[model samples]
Target: MMLLIKNAEVYAPEYVGRKDVLVCGEKIECIADEIDRLPVACHILNGKGLKLVPGLIDQHVHVTGGGGEGGFHTRTPELQLSELISSGITTVVGLLGTDGTTRSVENLYAKTAALNEEGVTAYMLTGAYGYPSPTITGAADKDVIFIESVLGMKLAISDHRSPHVTIEELIQIASKIRVAGMLSRKPGILVLHMGDARSGLTPVIEAIERSSVPIRTFRPTHVNRNADLLEAGYEFVGKGGYIDFTCGMEGQPSPGECIVEARRRGLAKELMTVSSDGHGSWSNYAQDGTLLEIGVSKVDSMLQELQKMVKELSVPLEEALLYFTSNVAEAMDIGNRKGHIREGADADMILLDADLNLDTVIAKGQVMMEDKRIKKFGTYEHSK
Candidate 1:
């Protein structure tokens, strides 16, 4: 299949001005200023008055559903393909969250595979929020080295629900992942679930400081959950570590605000990224460690926040896009093909109208959504 998008203001995540892009099969074939010649059976899209950008890459989604804080009944439902396409997500990383017991890593892998087979690109992490990390292959390191879709491992720290893994245990996990990542040529990262506990990023900081493991081995998320954590996140970034901010968290500073503040503090923009935590549970806990309330996160929060960043917060479109596009791809070590809109990259992109509303979504050279309507649906989505 061939897709040609013409006369669109492109932000290959870096403002490339008006240009035409040709997508052949699942890769971008060419990006040029003018191409009058056409290929037989080629599909041409009129991109006038539209903004073309790389499709959003969400690295922290609960694809098989997250949450169980309240009870099993409160656990969120698994993600649907239409939800991701409508939100302009072309590549997503699935993972388990609090309930690693009931939600096995095997389920996460299956959902990741299903998403890929359904059209969009998907990957998953092994383990969850507990110690002795859960794995489909009996070990986290083995999962990374053997499982093709397994990118890294997930663990929580400083939160009440966490297993309170000691610093030694944390180092061991990082070391194992680091070695396996080298062997598998994967990122082999530890996606730390930053909690609201006062300890904040202490374990992560000490783990890096006391070991030979590189700073990038640890990817701490939800840094904006509290003022203290965000401050600690700054220090982590200063030490050459990347930090991810979660969007749509109530009572937390918006990701746009967090990025602006990080800029003001002279932090490197490349060290920062944002994720929706889609389908994950958001809960409020009392001082006594009781869950007060809980709700599922929406997959569209990243899009909403991007609009707010560019329109409300006055962030430049190119600058604001990094949080969802290039930055995430770089963090996950998939920048070579996942992010950017240049030739030789994956043909994953979204088109936005003048008002910054999503109009089209193309994933792996397939038109998943067009004119703000989903054209592709999961196998069971529309079935009676």
Candidate 2:
């Protein structure tokens, strides 16, 4: 398939001005100010008033569903293809959360493959919030080295629900992943689910300081859950570590607010990324740790927060886009193909109206959504 988008304002996550973008099959073919000659059977999209940017890459999502804090019945549902397409997410990384037993790494891997078969690009992390990390091949390092879709591992810290992993234990885990990542040429990162505990990022700080493991090996998320954690995230960034801010968490500053605040504090902008813990459970707990209520987070919050950043907070469109696009791809080591709109990159792009509303979504040169309507649906979704 060939797609030509003409006369659109392009951001490439850095303002490229008005240009025409060409896509051949699954990769971008060319980008120019004008191309008068058209390919045979090519589809031309009039992008006169639209803004074209790389499709968003969500680095932290519970693609197979998360939660189970309340009980088995409270587990959230798996992500649907339409949900991702409508939100302009062409690439995503799936991972498990609290329930590693009930939710096997095998299921997570299958769902990751399913998302790829359905349309959008998908990758996954092995393990959950537990210490002895769960894996499809009986080892976390093997999962990264052998499994094609497994990118890294997920673990929790500074939370009551966490297994209270010690610094030595954390370093060991990072070491294994680091070596395995080197072997597989993947990030092999340990994505830490930051909690609101008083310890904040102390353990992660000590782990990096005391070990030979690089600071980039640890990707702490939910840094915006509270002021203290966010401050700690700034410190982590100062130490050459990357931090992720979660969108759609109640009582937390929106990812947009967090990014603006990070900039205000003069933190490293390239080291910060944002994600929507999509399809993951969001629960309220009593002071005594009783589960008060539970609800699922929306995937669209990623796009919504970006819109708010540009339209409401006065952030430049290119600057607001970095957290969702290039920054995330770079953090996960998929920058060469996934995040940019340059020629030879994957043709995963989204077109936005003047208001920054999602208008069209193209993944790997295939139109998934256009004019704010879904053109492609998951295999089972069409029946519904």
TM-score of each: 0.99, 0.98
Error of 2 at 55 (Å): 0.1
Q: Model 2, which residues run further than 4 Å from truth?
A: none
List model 2 lDDT by residue over 1-384, tens digit each.
889999999999899999999899999999999977774879888899999999999988899999988888998998899999999999999999999999888999999999999889999999899989889888999999999898999999999899999999999999999899999999999999998899999998898889999999999999998899988898899888999989987887888888788888888999999999998898877889988999998889999999999989999999999999998998888999988899999999999998898999999899998888899998898684
- Give Cα distance to truth, residue 95, candidate 1, Å: 0.5
Candidate 2 has a TM-score of: 0.98
The per-model lDDT (C-alpha) reads: 0.93, 0.92
Candidate 1 wrong stretches, greater than 4 Å: none
Candidate 1 lDDT, tens digit per residue, 1-384?
999999999999999889999999999999999867774778888899999999999999999999988887998999999999989999999999999999999889999999999999999999999988888889999999999999999999999889999999999999999899999999999999999999999988888888898999999999999999999998999889999999987988999999999899999999999999999999998899888888999899999999999999999999999999999998888999987998999999999999999999999999998878889999999788
